[model samples]
Target chain A: MSLEVKELFKKYGDKVVVDNVSFSMPGPGVYALLGTNGAGKTTSIRMILGMLEKDGGSVTWEGKPLNFDTCNIGYLAEERGLYPKYSLMDQLRYFGELRGVDRKTVDERIKYWAERLAVEEYIYQKKGKKQQSPDQLSKGNQQKIQFLIAMISDPQLLVLDEPFSGLDPVNTDLLKGLVREQIAAGKYIIMSSHQMEAVEEFCTDITILHRSKVVVSGNLNEIKKASGRVNLRLKVEHDISSFIRDAGVELITEKEYEYVLKVTGDDQANGLLKSLIAAGIPIVKFDLSELSLHEIFVNAVGDEAKEVQE
Target chain B: MNDAENIYSIRGIEKVFLFTVRQTFKNRGYLLSFILFVLVFTLMGPIQYASSQAGRGAAEKSMSKDVEISDVENVFVCDQTGILDESVSDLGSVDGNVSFVSDESVVSDSLGKNDIVIVIKTNETGFIINGIISDSSDISNDTLDVVTSELQSIFDDTRMKKSGISESDIELIYSGVSVDDPVKESDLYVNKDGGKGKENKIQSGSYGLYMLGFAMVVFIVISMSSSYIITSVTEEKQSKLVETLLVSVRPMALLMGKVVGMMSYVVLVIICGAIGSTLSSYLMERFLGIDKSNYGGSSYDFSIFTSFGIVNTLFLVLSILLAFLLFGMVSGLFGSTCNKTEDIQVATGNVMTVAMVGYFSAMVIGFMDNDTVNLLAALIPPFSFFTAPVAFLGGRISGVILAVAYVIQLVVIVIVLRVSAKVYRLLLLNGNTVPGIKSVLESVKGA
Candidate 1:
């Protein structure tokens, strides 16, 4: 019931592409692998899925090697691919059959997914017209077909790499909803994306890689809680720049009498708010929140870059 | 990972095979090419026969128009063979006074300047018709030739009539006469002092042509099928479907499936070709009254199945299949090196060069009439695939040598498959231009 990837490593000649990456699922949930471009996110996913040769370590499920025999797995690769000249229905059926799904079930699943993803017209041929090929469909539609192929077998473990890269907002929401459903159905999923908010919405645990090494790895909530509430948002009716200077607060940004500040803890925030009240500034808004996933990712990667520079 | 794990697996091969076959048939270009292949093979014989018949008719008409005998005043016929009658003088377009003479010497001496004497005499081989004209006669050579030709035709007709052979039976009588020096069954494959024993010179010449022809056919079949394999492999690569496919099936399985799938198409085309050729032969014989056996002036007893019997025919078929698989695998290996659709032509060219070398070498060596060279060529790969079967059927090489050639071909096929599998696995994910020999070697080493 758990997927474990331990100390996975990959190197090409003198370049270490994925170095000592490790993580585990422990249960049915979404685990996110996030990093900047060329940060080894896709590489780690490829190694875990056995698509690429690993220089070190093993990927195991339920204490055994993870493979097609041990667990039914689905992979949505970063690079979207389909037989451009082949019919979409034919490609989907072929993928389903390759994964050992029977024809009847494959057709049923295709029908279900085609309808659910709103691609039935492209997949099913009308009276005399030809079935649509991948090339004939738009790129977003082609991606939907690829996604359907990954889900046709209804695999227990699914790995999606950059699943939302080129999708428009509407299609992105559609995919996000499907991921949530899979989570609800108790399937183990690993998703990698540059869209931080999407990852934040679905992932319970995460590992952030920078320059081929993990900089942050833990449950999302625990990581956020440990960092504490350091972001302060304040909105006032009048200018409070002079009182903010007296309280010695770090001014991150200001716009139209509303202020965004950084503080060490609640004490600093309380002191700033107390001064604002005593100065008789009408408090329109005062909010304290933990760091967003985007901020956390930037800070972690930024710190790593500074260390490398030093 | 072990070598077996990395390089050998058939899991999910059937899906790959079926998909490849379905897509290939769906491709309009491939379907059109297949139809054309069958049509050409089927119509080739009939077309050639009809053209040759037309050429013969035109030649006859031209010859008749060019011949003139109006200057001759008389034609004296001496029927020395006793087969011709007084009607022999009326055999041609001669407007002269035609008369039969009793003695050839007296008639020949009495021939005037404008007269020619037609003498029909029997030799041991057959009748010999000679036109005799006086040394001072003004009769032209053309006139003499016309008279001689007319006398020969008359003599033939009269002789056939005297012998009671009907006109309809003339074709049967003049049909191809096949000569064979029968040897004991065990002596068929026995090479007596490295010499061809009891081999008819004419049959050997025909057999050489047959060998060359068969080698061309093998070259064509392998080349066409290998190109299909190359295209199929590069299609998958160019579409960037390798990663998704690798998860479902191993590299070797994918390659094996595609090769077998394309070969199945080749087999279908070959069957169609056989049907077309058979149809053409039937059409020629039934409608044109032309018999292939008699057309070339030599017996066509060179059919592999008929000449070598069933066992060797099976062996020949096996060698052909192995040869096809070997070439197909090599093509797949080259195709794996391709990263783009543009690389397909170069990959196909590399494999075709190997096939061309095999085909031409077999053709050139097959015509040499040397048993040792034929036997050696038949035991070598690439060439053996093309030459061995025909050589064995022609008795240029013994059965043992052919069997040895089969063994060598199988070994070569195994080696090629292994190498192909290794290269395919190593390079399936590589996204670069077609790799060179050094890169391939490096990849192989790493694998």
Candidate 2:
């Protein structure tokens, strides 16, 4: 059985947010959702999760309507909401019960999560006493609890919207590991994070939302490769405006010791290296590859905006 | 199922439920206040009861342990039938104490001197009495007439002042006659359930307690559930937990879990309060020795309410409680549409309005004692739970009707639960703070 979100669309009085989005999401794997700001990535996720009614099309489990009885899913919104007044253990246990998990198991899971997160000492602290209302926990700790809530149920589908927003690097890595643990165990996770590097490290499949539409999707490597914009970085000795004018690329980031060139779709990358070599330019080094997820997302959004203006 | 899949299944959701309960309790949430409120209320029951309890035989006791009345005296002379007494001169000759003359002419003059003068008159139509009652009287001062002799004589049945009077035809007088009640019947009978052999009286002092307890339960339950629903909803929406929660249990379950959890405290408070009140009432009656029977109970009939009848009524109320559960869940679920805590008040305010309407209806039904209120309340879900009890308490509704009303209430609960569950599922999943009633209603109607 699969989650089928078909041709889903959402609009708010002429401002279309989710545009005819469609995806047959795979079960039990990590799928990164990449997008720039205002890309409607969050909106698309809501439509797919059946939280918002799509203006068009339907979301189904296998072939039936995605009713509550048929499935168990967990979501950690971008906001990382937890009850501030509820103790960490209490909140997690409540989320567990929400999924129909029994009382004993809820307790055991609370202990496990409390211990895992290393906050077991404060498990019984009155939220008021500790001032640990959901609002009280540090961003990272709140994210930890959010993760605990979503993962506590071992949901069939786990949706994480900006899951790593307020997390520090160390905590981010910890979360990364926990997220991987869920994925490796064949637990389906559809996650969106602003941490591009983190997403690159974990995602097998990726979907890029640009202006409420799926601009680029499928395999991460493929989408990056399919961006059709090759990035070439050159270490320059002097201002290479003269050399750059001859050719090489349209997208360019010329920084000290590093000049990034997005060469168009062609085998001209090797020829550019030859031309630079012939010009006697002291190129420190060169790294050639398809566009990064960020670069691809930028280009996708740019192109979509251009299309809208046109 | 394989071990790997079930591990998350068993471990995940279960953890959430217990964690919530623990969270709720640790926060000194509903449980603490509920216990305190109940204890206070229970203690209040006695306070109120002390005022309402009837003045029993103890009221008749005229003498204190340390003192005696030297100027007054009482006698049980069976002279209503005018049997000749050999020592009439001896009664009038008591130096300090005065003797009550049974004759009207003698009684008028000696009324000032006598402590008690009970006259028994036996004519054809049962026995009657014409003895004068004075303000200066003892609680235990009753005219006694236990005649051991078999000879024919006149007797007065003074205590049954309004007996055989058409109960319906009784006038709307301000004052009610005094009657003592031995409330706890060790063995209950189904004989002429109400207004017959025994009727439970609500004493004056206890009246205040009953009213207070009722108000406290009404206001507090609404208060607890109100914030409980609004805050929990807005919190979930704010944190975006609604989506995760909706996936596993249907919005109804999450709503149920929350309100149900809070209600556990409400029930606890009520039980504790009940026990406390019982003990307090006893204490007040013992120590303060206040007689509240002066307030009311000229006419009382618990025949409309029996232990069995109460149980049946209680069964109906349980249905009402179930209805409250749904109401709370729905309120919470609906209120959560707001993305922020600020907007929660409005959503829950609407909920409060609905709850208040039900509470008022219950109070009105309690005082007015109408069948329509009972019938309508039973069908209206939340209102049914409130009004049904009032109807039963007032003895305006029968056990059969109560059962049926509650049964109807129970069905409404199921229906409300199902619908609210739907709304919960749809609305909770979205963390949109501004969706408002339009979206919620659409989801409910759309579903």
Candidate 3:
């Protein structure tokens, strides 16, 4: 099924938060939505979920308008909330009831999750009374429960906000694997995160939000190539000021000994290499680097927008 | 956490609410305190009753107001029931009071004299007698007024006769003494109409307990359900569970679930209080052996008290239920709006204030009749239930009227729930504080 968001606009009083945002994201694979803080990323996610009313716009899933029924689609809001006093099984079952899951399955799924999450010891406790609370669990464990709350519905489209947050590296890896598992099972996954490595590793398609507008989006590699950005690394015997004065290449970073240049445009890097050699700059090693998602973010939303406007 | 990637549904939100309530009750600190406190207070019932039986003040004053006959008392008495006969004479001689049921036995009613006054028995209604004035007794005019008011009550009764005299009877029934001269020199602070007697502490205790039951029911219903809401929402927000649930289920549904959960809590507390009250009252009556029927009813027959008691009990129960529903729903709506436990504290704090105001206002309204609160309370959301109970207690309203008020309040609650649910869906997850009172208007205006 296709999700289409057209000309969406949201205003907070006189301030425009989501301005004429438009997108058509067909799911079944992870879609990485990227943005800086205060970039209206959260606002747009809320609008897309139909949780917040837009000033003027439309969001349709499979050509049907969004409403309570469309709510069957799962979501993990940017700020997740679970009953602090809820136990893992109790908390999961409670949400399962609201989602209209069968009563019998709630227990089954809860058992499954408890074992899978390795939180079984925490369940079925007679500590005080009949119930357990989420607060009794650790934060990471709480996040695990929150994740299941969104995923247990087996929603056709899953929207996760900062799923990797508060996760240790190992747990993050575990969740990253889960994302692929969901995708392989033919579930659509759309995740928003500030982690560039995670996005670059898993997101097949990406959307960058800046100042309440989409600045750059689509296939990660294609977007990077279109900007003519090539990651470069170099090793030199000595610092050469004359070798640095190149027409089509710019330094990306300079360590104490070696300078790294970002070469742009076709043939620009080859000609720069020759120019550097003719200047007798001893290059020990050089290789084209892979583009990081952060560079892409800075390219699309950082100084590029300012330079273009000027 | 590999298997943690299982599916969840919005229906789980409802389960969460119920689970929270059950756990709250199961919590040892609160439940233990509540049980212990109520039990201790309940045991005090027997102690209070025993110590209060003989104390006298207003008890004596009010006692001295009802049906006192005296002196040669020439008892010209008649009774359709034939419960008393001629040997009952000191009859007219009830202590030292005499009556002339002759030409002047008649007294004026607001509707003019229709042989309304009864010295002993005149044309069926009780006593019709005029006391001859003696210049001697040192009682105040206020006492005379008290005697007149009580006599008015006795004369209106269709079947009362003088008899069954006891040694202590004379001391309690001497309100009006005949004196031609008015004592204008001394100042009287007591109500001109209410005339004071020795106030009976046990009787006052009885009234206080009745009111205590009322206030407890109201406070427990509102507060218990409200605390359920606060803790429930706070936990949800804190655990980040609300985010996903907000997507699949509407805020209104979540709100409804919470309201239902809290409603269960309120209902439980009310039932408990009712049981406690019944037990206390039963114990008090057994121990004190009070004949409070005369203190409260319009006639010695006590049929009026019985009928009024039934009506008041029914209305009290129903109004309390409706009022609790209204309060729980509104508090749930507001509680769900907060995004953090601390935020919930602030949110429910404001909600608690409203409940407290409504309850105290209701208590204050109990002492006055025909105030704006009496009229306003019949329609105001939470206050209606309370005021209706007070009115029923005063015998100021009929069951049909109370039932109508209850139905109207129920209808208002339904409307509020429906409208609140709709708006709640849109606003539940927003991190900003909604302007409290104006939110409804803003929703209606869609602004």
| The candidate that achieves the highest lDDT relative to the unseen native structure | 1
Best by TM-score: 1
Isolated chain B TM-score per model:
0.76, 0.56, 0.52
Q: What is the TM-score (0 to 1) of chain A in model 1?
A: 0.95
Q: lDDT of each model, Cα atoms only? A: 0.80, 0.60, 0.61
For candidate 3, report its TM-score. Answer: 0.67
Give me the displacement of residue B172 in model 3, in angstroms: 18
Compose the digit string of candidate 2's lDDT tens values, residues B345-403: 77777777777777666556455544575567645656665655544443445667777
How do the residues A1-310 of candidate 3 rate in per-residue lDDT, one tens digit apiece? 8777787888866799888877677766778888777778888887777666678888887787754366457777667556554356666776677667887987787777666666666666766665446566666777777777776666788888888889888888888887878778987677888877877777788888888888887887787666664666777788754565645568777876577877764477677677778878778877765567877887778875444334
Please tell me how candidate 3 rates in CAPRI terms.
acceptable
- Residue-by-residue lDDT tens digits, candidate 1, B15-69: 9899988988999999999999999878766666667668779999888767667
Write model 2 residue lDDT over A130-249, tens digit each, in one string: 444566667777777777777676677778887777878888777777777887777777878766777777787888787678887788777766666477777767777666667746
True contacts kept of each: 0.52, 0.51, 0.62
Counting clashing residue pairs in each candidate, in order, gives 1, 47, 55
What is candidate 1's TM-score against the reference? 0.86
lDDT of 2 at A206: 82
